[model samples]
Target: MQITFWGAARTVTGSCFLLEHEGHKFLVDCGMFQGNKALKQRNYSDFPFNPAEIDFVLLTHAHIDHSGLLPKLCKHGFKGNIWATEGTVDLCSVMLPDSAHIQESEVEQKNRRLLRAGQPTIEPIYTMEDAAKTLTLFKGIKYHQLVKPAENIEVVFYDAGHILGSSVIQIKYTEAGHEQIVVFSGDLGRYEHYILHDPDNIEKADYLVMESTYGIRFHEEEKSKEDLAKIINDTFKRGGNVIIPAFAVDRCQDIIMHLNSLVEAGLMKQGSIYVDSPLSVKATDIFCDHPEYFDEDTKALAEKYGTCPLKTKNIIFSETTEDSIALNKVKSGAIIISASGMADAGRIKHHLRHNLWRPESTVLFVGYQAEGTLGRRLVNGEKIVRIHGEEIDVKAQIVALDGYSAHGDQTEMLKWLSNIKEKPQNIFLVHGEESAMGQFAEIISQKTGIATLIPEMGESYKLNDLAHFVEKQKLAIDESGDMMELYLDINQQISQMMRAKEWQKLFDIKEFLHKIS
Candidate 1:
């Protein structure tokens, strides 16, 4: 068996992995590229392998970064079944079509400009019809249930506690008469996540493919309700609206629950709170329908409230374009929550265009912002930004509450790893920035004494000869004369040392390099 790191190798988005065994090819995730223009442009690039050749796909969740490319995969002639949890299937039912709409809308807007400039027109990556067809291939599996999507491979799902029906997948396969177990940690969630259950603990695995999205950070312990209330109150006092860009699936519902609690506690004044994303409205309904997936606290909260956990007193769901446009009339005392958490697209951009330049308003971020995203630029304190091709000065207050993050932080991820009684033979970290992946590799190596590999994009590993594969990789890089590769490798080593605070070792390495030069 062989594995390839097609995406999310040294970045936080575009999570695709290819597994080939005994002439059969399968995919773990067919995610879309997001964040910076370089990464986003990758979405339009041809697949490294022919999508038509893929036998099946093991979908872990419905997040766009994990499952967004199913339509494109289907459009490219993949006729295989896509296996996922029931909740994931339901979420994708709405999300995929919505994603297609966004793509179409964006392409249409870009085409107008190109038409005027006499440039070639572009097409959307996939259409709504493609998304609809992709849904026909979905085969829903219940949590903890085992199934085989291909010969000699058995798969099981564990609740990942990330979103409504997110999962950690385990694949049991046979290679050369040897049985092996490989576990994929599909965006593990926090232990005390408000809506979902804690991530399930796996007892054993031979190989582990884990995510390291927050590998170098920890979630803030401070309760975000107080901070949110203060931001709202302060903004309202100045007669401005609080515009929030949130993820439609998990973060949006989480924010709604928090706002409901604040209102119930009388900590927030009663005012119009608009959920402006149609995708979010549908996602919230799906979330409410699956009460079985909720944590104990969330279930109890639902019981106490006598309604959905997300339904607050002053909440308004705006489903139509006109209704969304009407929100612009409310200049102050309104809390507008929109989708596309990174604020790169969707109605949130329109909302930002109206309020981001207002000194009295505030733009609150309740999720992780990938590098080069609009949210990252705002959070990083860029004074001027462009929205809808118009440059706007950023006068509004920008705030990020890390406590609302859905991904488990470094400490929580380590705790999750400790659950495996026996360490895996190899641990590969993906879905993180280069620096975070480097820092995490060191921490995992020290804690478990297991070999950890951070595979670069297009890198491959043979499952049967893991040690030899790693040694070959080390030799290849060590023997290479490419200055840029050497420089990056040295920088990663220095970063790891700095993170460990080993000043002596860092100084010694720098001095040794200087002497050798």
Candidate 2:
């Protein structure tokens, strides 16, 4: 048996991992890599392994960074089932296709330049058709149902509380004659979020793979709500447009909830608030579909108030392009929440271009901004920014509310790990940047005294004892198992370079590994 880190090892985007036991393979999460141009370029390249060879894909949530590459896998020929909660499936139905649309349009635009340069035009990574095809392979299941995705490999889903349908997967497998439990903490959510339920309890595991997106920082949840209200009140009083680039999934909904509370409490007027993104419109519907995933506070609010906060009067779900275009009509004191939270692309760019130059306008950030993204530049106080190929001076009030982040902070990450009964022989720190992962690695070693390895992309750790148990257990390999083949192909493609270069490919391989494993 072996565990390979393909993606999200030392950086925050493109998550994939592979587990091989007894010649059978299983994938953990297949997320898309995001941020800087170089990282985004990787999304256009082929998978190191054959997508068709993967047996099964275990999904964690619906965030594009976690599950955006599914359409590409399907386009490349993966035919196995994708297991996820019902909410996750529904979210993907909208997200994956949207991602495909973005890719297709991007490729088309890029190909024109390539063709002019006398280079052969390349194909989009995947098409909307491929995304449509992938949707049929999704198998929706309830949380905590112990089922074997493959023979002798029991899989269970626990609430991660990161977003609607988010989960932490508990995997119990036998290799050789030994039993091992491997837990993948998909993206740990803050204990108390505005919309979703609290993160589920940590189950015991022999091996635990956890996320450390905010491992180096501390966030105050209460202060964030207060700050948000203050920002809105200040902006409304001054007659400025408050523009927020929020992720349509959790952050967008959460912000709306906060705004709704402010309006009801009379701290802020019920000013015109528009959620201007098609993805957000669909996402809100999905949020309404699953009341089971809501926290007690959210449930009580829903019961007491007919519609959830942000979905009612004064808060408009701007679904159509025309609706979004109509926002320009309201020039004063209007609040617009758009998508692509990092401000890399999407409707947020248009909003920024229109409002960032206004001294009274405010661009309130309430999510994590990966390095090299427009959001990070804004946070760092870049005075001028380019939007859709035009440079615009940034004169608006820029405020970042770190407390509103969905990912657990450094203390929370450690607290979650402390819940585990015993640390396994190996602990892998992933889904974070180098700084965050390094800090997390050091703290885990000091606190738990466990050997933690952050593998570079495509790096393989041979489990001599674990492999023996895998053979002893003789788990069944279904026709769906393409994961092993993919891993082997990736290894073969990068091994020479990986060894000769001494970890140059480590991060890239880890990002790639994040997809299938």
In terms of lDDT, the best-performing candidate is 1
Q: Where does model 2 exceed 4 Å of error?
A: 224-226, 464-517
Report lDDT per candidate.
0.88, 0.81
Q: Per-residue CA lDDT of candidate 1, range 1-517, in tens?
A: 7888888888888899888888889999999989875577677666778899999999999999999888999999999999999999999999999999988897787667556655566678889999999999999989999898888999999999999899999999997788888889989999987889999989788899999999999888846567678889999999999999999999999888888888888889777788999999999999998998999999998899798878756689999999999998889999999988999989999999999999999999989999989999999999999888688999999988888899999999999999988678999999999987988999999999989999888888888845235221111211222222334446767887999999999889889989999
What TM-score against the true fold does each predicted structure earn?
0.89, 0.88
Best by TM-score: 1
Error of model 1, residue 26, in angstroms: 0.5
Q: Kindly give the number of clashing pairs for every candidate.
A: 0, 40
- Error in Å for residue 321 of model 2: 1.3
What residue runs in model 1 are displaced by over 4 Å at the alpha carbon? 465-517
lDDT of 1: 0.88
